[model samples]
Target: MSASLAPECNEVKERYDSCFLKWYSEKFLRGTARSDECDPLFKQYEQCLSKALKAKGIDNMLKEAREDNRENDAEHMRPKR
Candidate 1:
């Protein structure tokens, strides 16, 4: 885990990061972008982070970052015409 912004989520982030790195190497690098493998763990980590962010009154920052991420992903995934 790369040091979570919210200290409270550090442990959750570490677990999720480990799962993600394993999945990334075994699945993603092997030619798949599937997320089902880590969906539950990711959701758990997200929940932890969300609570921390909300508590610190930084949920809006989190929302903006999520929006930016979604937009970037969408742009990259869009069909080239």
Candidate 2:
């Protein structure tokens, strides 16, 4: 329904979003989904998105965001004892 981060990947993203929503609501929510029905569509969208992120030089940012940060978690956020 919304535009993708990469305009070029919008169509693929839309297809993946639609299939994912349908599968999630009609099958997953109802406990009838044998597996994700949108895997292929999602994969296609992911590929397009990856290329776009790399083109825009934000792939590393995303990679960093996805990494676990517990080891480097800020002590300032911890409650004082």
Candidate 3:
């Protein structure tokens, strides 16, 4: 997998990635995943990533991007002319 945006978060991200892969392949694809098996790992990874994004002033940009995409989602769902 690719490294995280922040070098400091890379380790946590890797741990999360590994857990996600195992859960996805072993339980998710098999239709046996009862709950989010990677939630804790994901939370840790998200915390690290969020800190990195805030440090680099990218959190706002990402938030804006998400808002922009949300606004466009409805438009995109309509039949094309």
The candidate that wins on TM-score is: 3
TM-score of 2: 0.77
How well does candidate 1 match the true structure in TM-score terms? 0.71
- lDDT score, candidate 2: 0.87
Model 1, residue 11: distance off in Å is 0.9
Clashing pairs in 2: none
TM-score of 3: 0.81
Writing each residue's lDDT as its tens digit, candidate 1 over 1-81 gives 489988878888898899889988888989877556888888988998888778888988878898779878988898898
Q: What is the C-alpha RMSD of each candidate to the true structure, in Å?
A: 3.0, 6.5, 4.1
Q: Model 2, stretches more than 4 Å misplaced? A: 68-81
Per-residue alpha-carbon lDDT of model 2 for 1-81, expressed as tens digits? 899989989999999989988998999999999977799999999999999889999988877775757555675567789
TM for every model, in the order presented, reads 0.71, 0.77, 0.81
Q: Candidate 3: global Cα-lDDT?
A: 0.90
Model 3 agreement with the true structure over 1-81: per-residue lDDT tens digits: 998878988998899999999999999999999999899989988988898888899989998899879868887889997
Supply candidate 3's per-residue lDDT for 23.
Answer: 94
Question: In model 2, what lDDT does residue 21 have?
Answer: 89
- Badly placed stretches (over 4 Å) of model 1 are 32-35, 64-74, 79-81
